[model samples]
Each structure stands twice: as C-alpha cells, then as structure tokens.
Target chain A: MTVMTTAPDKRDNAPILSVRDLKVHFPIPGKGLFAKDRPLKAVDGVDFDLYPGETLGVVGESGCGKSTLGRAILQLIAPSGGQVAWLGKNIVGIPHRDMQPLRRDLQIIFQDPLASLNPRMTIGEIIAEPLVTHKPELGKDEIKTRVKRMMARVGLLPQMINRYPHEFSGGQCQRIGIARAMILEPKLIVCDEPVSALDVSIQAQIVNLLQELQREFDLSLIFISHDLSIVRHICHRIMVLYLGNVMELADRDSIYANPKHPYTKALISAVPIPDPEIERNKERIVLTGDLPSPLSPPSGCVFRTRCPFAQEKCATDVPTIDRVSETQEVACHFHNSI
Target chain B: MMNKSEKTALLQSASAAKEIEGRSLWRDARIRLFRNKAAVGSMIILGIITLLAIIAPLLSPYAYDQIDWGYIQEGPNWENGHIFGTDGNGRDLFIRVLYGARVSLAVGLLATAVSLIIGVTYGAIAGYFGGKIDSIMMRFVDVLYSLPFMFFVIMLMVVFGRNIFLIFVALGAVEWLTMARIVRGQTLSLRRREFIEAAHATGVSNFKIIFRHVIPNVLGPVIVYMTLTIPQVILTESFLSFLGLGVQEPLTSWGVLISEGAKVIEASTWMLIYPAVFLALTLFCFNFIGDGLRDALDPKDR
Candidate 1:
C-alpha cells in the first residue's frame, strides 16, 4: 500500500488520553453449580497513547475488540481492569455521577448512525441533548441557538432540526450524531466505524467531514473501523488488532509501507487498490483460518493460530509487543525475519 | 442588511420549518388514529356516553333513586316519562344507567392511571439497570403475581371496609403487576437499543434516562395493555359487586346495576338491557381504540 501522507507529526505536548493494559472481560455463567464460570477476554492487556489533536485509527475484523477498546477509552463500557487516563487523570472506576462532567470532554460517535439517534426525538432535540446535560446554565434559547449552529456546521439544514431522525437519510443521521458529539466541543471523540453503514460515496463525505472537524476543533479522535482503505486516509497512526490483541501499532506511512506483523500484512493486502494495474500486480497475503474465538483465545500469540509462519514455539510463548523503530511496534517473535 | 439570496434562504427555511414543527409522535399518532374509522366512531360514541354520564341528572326529571310505587315493575311507557322505563323498585333505569356510567368510567380511568404511574416507574427502573436489582425487583413482582387477586381484594375490603376509593386502590394495586411486566419486557429490549446506549454516552443521568428514554419507548406497549386492562378492571368490579362486596346502596356502579339487572331479567328486561348495553358498548369502544392505537403507534407499521 502506498503511503497516504498526513499533517506534520507534532508530539510537543503531553498526551490527551493514555490507555494501559485495558482489559474488558465478560463472565459467561457455568452450566452447573460446581462448574466455574469462564471470563471472555474481549480486550486483553492493550496499551496506547493518544496525543492531543491526533486521530488514532483502530483496524480489526469482526469481534476483535475494536469497538470494545473505543468504548473502554470513553468509559462507555466498564473495563474489568487497567487504567484510562484522560489528560493524565485516571477516569476508570469513577462512578457514573462523577463521570458526567468528564463526558463533556470525552464523547463518542457510534457505528450505526440511525440506531445512535433516538427515533422519537427530533433532530434538534438529539443534537441539543449533550448541551442540555452539560450546560444547564445555558438558557433554552441559548441551547437552541447552539444546536442550530451545530446542525449547520455538520452540513445539516438548521430548518430540518424539527424533522425526526427517521425522516433523514443515513448520511444525515450520521451528521446529527456528529453534531451531538461535537456539541460539547469535546476534546476527544471516538468515531467507531461512523461511515461503515453509509454508501461508498457517503463514506468519503463523512470521513472528510470528520477530518475537517478534527482539524477545526483540534480534537483527538479514535477512528475504529475494519476498512483499511478509509482508515489509511483519516488516521495519522494505525493500530492493527487480531483476536482481541494488537498485532501492530505504527505511524500510518510506516504501517502501510512496511507492515512488520504477518497479521497486519494479511489485513493490508486485503484492501483493493483503485487502480487496476496496481491492484493486479500487488502481492496479497491470504491467511488460511478464521479469527479464533475470544472466549478461549490461542494461549501464545493470539495471531499465531492464523499466522502463516506459526511454529511449535509460537504455541507456547506469547510474543510481547516489540518496538522495531521510533514510529512502529510489532507483536511477532519473528518480525525481523518475516 | 441581508443580501437577496440570504433573505430568500431565511424565508425558505422559515416556511419549511412550519411544515414539520407539529409532526411529533403523538401528533402523527393522533392523525393515524383519526384515519382509523372504527377508532374515530368509537371515540365519538365514548365521548357522547361520557358527556351524558356527566349531565344525566340534569337531563332526567326523575332522580336516580326516586321510587314511584304507582309504577313499580313498569315497562317502557311514554306516559310515565321513563324513556328507559323503571327498575324493579320503580327508579328510573335511564338515570341509574347514566349514574352507573360515572362510577364505572371513573374507576376504570383512575385505577389505570394509578397502575400506569406505579407500573411504568417500577418496570423502567428494573429493566434499565438490569442484573441483581432487576432480578430482585422482578422476583418481588413474581411474589405479588402469585397472591390470589380475589383473596387480596377481599382482604383489603374486609380490613378497610368496601368503599369506592378502596376499589380503585385494590384494582389498581393488582392491575399494575401485568403492566409492569409488559413494560419490563419492552424495556429489556429497548435497553439494548443503540439510542439508549447513546443516551448513556451523552452523560444523561440514570433517572433521566429511565423516564425520558426508557419509558417513552415502552409507552407503545403500555398504552395497548392499558386499554385491555380497563375492561378487565370493570369486569372485576362487577364480579366484586356480584359477591356483594362492592359499592354500597345509594351510590351505584355499572357493576351494581348489572348485578341487579341479572336477578330480574325475567321480570323487567330494561334493567338488564340498558346498563349491559352501555357496558358492552364502552368495552367495545375501548377495544377498538386500543386496536387503533396499537396500529398507529406500531413502528412496524411506520
């Protein structure tokens, strides 16, 4: 994959969000009284730092804990273990009441646009909800003015505010979701596959809208998606996930240009190039097996079961994330060789 | 100071705003309800019945309990001015049936209102916060559900003494169980919907989320169940009256009239027919209205 250049890398300031060893495990009940219940490790020991005004893209196949990680960062889903530090303060385990004020700074955009919006609420009310919660001091007229302005900012007609979400198209509903998330002028916004539900044409539009808003608001965005092509454009850095673990995390150019992990290679190889000549000539690494279930993941390196170069040693030993360069981290034992 | 294009834009948005302003869920449902012929007809009939119930004394010359020994067990006759004729005791049947309407309708509405308040709050809180609290709350509901309804009402009547207000409390206390169950079931499904999750992400309080988000979403089912419950409540009231444990003399209900009517069907058929017709009509109207509301509020239909 050719490198899609982004804005100049700036790491002058402290990180806005830091996630360390974040694990979300759900307990599945046992069959009988004597049987011990097993915990489904959906996200196990993941770590990342999100700088202010940077977009971190998380890429993974279905059920690989991409959405779970995004939700955990925003405290939307409780992480069974680990720390989610927002602006250097650990926000994990904070009661929901205390979490409310923090929510004004941290917001999320969901995958299903229409589902994210309340069907009963008018577009105006949906967008104004965050304002209603956080800015109680703001009068009704002030909130309405802010909502209408936000609506216009997100490319929705201010007049259409009175219309229900059902009346709007998928793209428009997504804009409303964006408007709601952006209403509080949050420092960080989690875009959890915000464009996966839209048409191909609308996907570009929404992605462009997000990029523009990220720049305008100077917002740190966690863009989570399975679509590598779209992620390459929007994300400054990309994290490849397989079976609830990070296979690789690197600067976008380096990850695309020189993908170290076999899992990352297989994922990038799947993205179809727009040019037929390059598409046909490009080498595609097709893995053999499906993603292992998170319930009882492979004991060693989570990706080893599906890794093309899996050895007997790979089954017994977990490959910790090894930093290959200043801008890249790969979690594979033989990343140097293959 | 606005440009021509800006002025046009303002005018256009202003006009466009008007078209969609009143298109709320209730407004749409009302429109759909009116479109349903049966529901509309039922509404008109129910309205007129409620109106007549309110002004029955003013309309009728003979008092509801007035006894004219001269016309005992009389059949319908224009000369005596008893349009619906006289009951076994020579009291006007028309006036009694209308007065009964006041009692029966009030009980149905007020009891349902009571159940609605308790049931919706109980069920929404239980479902929205699921797990231990939900399990315990629902188990409590199960305990209540197991309490034999007749026995409970009888106990209440025995302890508190049978009065019009006690009937409302007894019926409402029991009726809310099913309403809570229906609401809980709906809330269980709705709690998982992305919108509810979105509300949580927005930092809306748990209290606000339950009332603003959960309850409104479950209202479609709650409303349908309520219509069905009213007739059920009315029937229970009649059953209690039949057992001679409800609504003492002087103050009458549809149930009391119906029970009295049942005993003397062979003698004066008007006593039975008048109140029975009114009760059946009211029940049918409620059923038809419920059907209309179910159709109107159904997301599937939309």
Candidate 2:
C-alpha cells in the first residue's frame, strides 16, 4: 500500500486539552464476604492530545471504552489515574466547586440527545441552562435572546424554543443537543457519538452541521464514535482504541490508507467501499472471537486473542506505541512484517 | 407556477402551521384529568364537601352542640328543620357531619403536607447522594419501619396530651417514612438519568438538579401518593378519635361522631348512617381522584 502524506507538522503549539495515561477502573463488588474486590479496567492507560480547531475521532468497538474515554477527558467521570490538563491546568480530582468555572470553556454533547436533555425543561431552558450556571450575571432577556439565536442557528425555529424534548424528532433533538453544547461557545467539545443515534439521512445533516459549527466557532472537538465512515469524513486525526488501549493514532488519510496495526488494518478493511467494483475486489479481514471481558483482558496485548497475526512475542511482551511516521504511531510488534 | 423563494416561503408557512401550540406536561396532565369522568365527578364531590365544611354553620339552623329536647332522636324531619335527624346529643346530625368534614379534611391535608415536605427532602438527599449516605439513610428508614406505628402514635398522644395539632404532627412524622422510601426510590432511578449527568456537566448545582430536575420528574408518583395519603391520615385520625384519644368536645370529627353514633345504633340508626356515609363518600372521592391523577400524570398513559 502506498503511504499518503499530508501537511507539514504544526503541533508545536500547545494543545487545548492534553490527556496523559488516563485510567478509569471501576471496582467490582466481592461475591462472598471475604472475596477480594476486582477492578474492571474500563479505560486503562490512554493518552491523546486535542488541539484547537481540530476534530480528533476516537473510534472502537462497543466494549472498547471509547465513551468512558470521552467522559474521562471532560472530568465527568474522575479518572483512576492520569493527568487531564485543560489549558495547561491539571483538572483531575479538583473539587466540583472549583471546576464549575472551568466548565464554561469545556462542554460535552451526548449520544442520546433526548436522554441528555431534561424532559421537564423546555428547549429554551435546556439550551440556556449552561448560561444560567456559568453566566449568572446575564439577565433573563439576554439569555432568552441568545437561546433563540442558538435555536435558529441549529436549524430549529425560534418559536419552537418552548417545545419539550419529546415533542421534537430524533434529528431535531440532536440539533437541540448541539445548540445546548455550543450555547456556551466552549473551546473544546467532547461529542460522545453525537450522530450515532440519529437516522442515516439525519446523521449526515448533523455531521455537516457539526463541521459547519466547528469551522464557524473555530472549536476543537473530540468526536467519539463507533462508525468508521463518519469518523473518516469529519476527523483530521483518528485514534483507534481496543479494550481501553490506544492501538494506533495517526492522521485520517494515513490511518485509512496505510494502517500499521493489525487491529486497525482489520477495522479499515471492514468498512465496505462505496464503489461496487472496488468493494468486490477488496480483501476483508474478519477477526475471530468475541471481545474478552474487561475484568480479565488478555495479557501482554489485549487484542492478541482476536488478532489474526498473533505470535509468541505478542503474548509474552506488550508493544508500546512506536513512531512509524511523522504523523502516525502504531502499537504492534510486527507492523512492517504485517 | 411558484418561484424558488415563494416556494420556500410557502414551505416555511406550511411547517409553521404544522407546529402545534406548545403545551406543558402539567397542562397536558390537567386536560387528561378533566377528560376522566370519574376524576371530574370526584373533584366535584370534593369541592362540594370542602364548601360544606367551610359553611357548616350557615348550612344548618341548629348549632352542632345544640340540645333540641322537643325533637330528640327525630329522623329526617326536613319540614321541622332537623334534616338528617338528631344525634344522641339531640344536635342536628347534618350540621355535625358538615363540621366533621372540616376536622377530617384538615387532618388529611395538613398531615400530608408535613409528610410531603419531610419525605421529599429526606428522600431526595438520600437518593441523589447515594452509596454510604444512601445506605445509612435507607437503613434508618428500615429501622423506623420496624417500629410499631400505632404504638408510636399512641405514645405520642399520651405524651402530647391528644391535642389536634399533636395528631397532625404525629401522623405526619409516621406517614413520612413511606413517602421518604417512595421518593428515594424515584430519586435513585432519576439520579442516574442522562439529564442529571447533563446538568452535572453544565455545572448546575447539586441542589438545583435535585429540586428542579429530579423532584419535578418524580412528582407524578409523589402527587398520586399525596392524594392516597390524605385518606390514610383521615382514617388514622378517625381511628384515634374512635378510641376517644382525638378531638375533645365542641370540635367533633367524623371518627368522634361515628363512635358516638355507634353507641346509640339500636335506638337511632340515622346517627351512624349519616356520619358513616359522609366519611365513606369523601374517602371514595379522594381515592378516585388519586387514581385519575396517577393515570393522567403517567407517561406510559400518554
């Protein structure tokens, strides 16, 4: 496969958010009275940086802890270990009272838009809630005006502001979610599968809306999704995660065209090409077996059990992320051989 | 025939027309409640009973405690002005029943309000802040639940000297245990919802989330429980009064009247029948309203 090269490195500028070796382990209760409590490693040792005016896509299978990583980055769920540096300040374990002010600059858009919005609150109230909390000095009329503008911007009518969440369709609700998140005009938004719950046609619209908004606001986004095609379309950089581990982090075109890791190769090959001619000729790599339980993930390499090119070394020793190219890093023992 | 801009304008107006006027959940529930025939009837009955309670003196010529020696134990003498006949005390049974409505309704309402306040707060705090606090608070509720409620009330009556105010407080204190449990269960489910997480993400204060988001959502069940609780409190108050531990003379409740009527049942059946019918009808009306509110407020019903 020919390597696809992109623009020159511009990463010297400080990242808006830097998450280093973040971990979120939930303790499973003991079955018996004297049984030892086991830790469920949902997100273990993940590292990434989200720069300003860029969309970093975190894509993985259902149980790969992509959602947990998104939440951990926002400090919604406290990381078990690691630094979540927001604008160079380590916000991990900070008191919620102290964190409240910082929340104005860091917001999140959830997957299930309807679920995320308070059912009792009107769309106006839902969108204005962030402002109410962060900007208490703003008058009610100012908040209302801002909410109406946001509603209109998100493709919703200003008059529809009083409608409840249930009154709106799924696509409209996602738009409301976007409006709510963007109402604060945050620097970074951790979109946890923002378009996953939407219909296919609606999904494209939401994705386009997000891209448009991101450009308009110059917003940095951490778009977490299981959909590879959607991620490839919107993200400048893509991070492949498996069982909470970062398998590969590379530029979008590099990751798709010349994926180094065996897992990434399998994932990219799984995305059926649009052209029937290319689709028929493409070689699909189907990995064997279900995902191992997070409670007792495979040793050395978590993906070794499902990886087709697993060897003795893959089981005995873990492969740390090795820099393959200027914009690509892969965590595999035999990336060249593969 | 239409141009692009005109077509877009027509479409916008069409969509605008399709936009139904916004109705709040409470307003929708109110409409649903009114549509329910039983609920509407019960509401009317409750209104009439409340009106009668307020104008008890105006409704009857004879005073509740008046001694009409000339017409002792007279039955249904509408012409003579003793409508529901005379009670054992020779007072107009109609007037006393109306007055009894006041005491019964007051006990029900005031006691339930006390319980609602205590229960919702205690439950919300316990449920919203789960884990150790939840376990400790719930365990305390369990301990309270284990205590013989009647014995507790009786003890309170003995200590507080059976004042009507004490009855209200005692009933509320006891009744709140269930309310706390119900509200806690609701809060447990509600606290985990994504909206709560969204609120947390927005840095909305914990108190605001609990009261504004959590409490309002759980209020469907709470309001239903409130209606049901009123009747329970009224019955408990009546039971206490029947045992001669509630409402002293000059202020007779339904329970007091019933107990007095039970003594003279063989001689004057109207005494027992009148008070009993009124109490039963009020309780039935309250229960109907409770059922209606539950169905109306239920999202499942929608």
Could you say which candidate leads in TM-score?
1
What would the per-residue lDDT of candidate 2 be over residues B1-302, giving only the tens digit for each residue?
45547755654564455334567788889999999999999999999999999988988888988989988888989798998998766778899889899999999999999999999999999999999999999999999889997788789877878688988988998899999999999999988788888888888998999888999898989999999999999999999999988898888999999998899899889899998999999999999999999999995964
Question: Once superposed on the true structure, which residue ranges of model 2 sit more than 4 Å away at CA?
Answer: A1-9, B1-21, B299-302
- Report the Cα lDDT for candidate 2: 0.89
Clashing pairs in 2: none
Interface RMSD of 1: 3.1
lDDT of 2 at B79: 94
Best-performing candidate as measured by lDDT: 2
Can you list each candidate's DockQ?
Answer: 0.49, 0.50
For each prediction in turn, the share of the native Cα contacts (below 8 Å between chains A and B) that it retains comes to: 0.48, 0.49
Q: What is the per-residue lDDT of model 1 for residues B182-269, given as tens digits with 9 covering 90 to 100?
A: 8888899999888888888889988898888888778887998899888888878878887888788877888888899899999778
- Regions of candidate 1 where Cα sits further than 4 Å from its true position: A1-5, B1-22, B299-302
Residue B273 lDDT in model 1?
89
Q: Candidate 2: TM of chain A?
A: 0.96
Mind giving the per-residue lDDT tens digits that candidate 1 earns over A1-338?
22353744667888888889999998988789888889999999999999988989999999999999988887878899999998889999987778878889988898899988887788888898999988899999999889888876777767777888878889989999999999999999999899999998889878877877887899889999989888888899999888778889999999989999998888889999889999999989999978788888988888887889998879999998999999999899999998
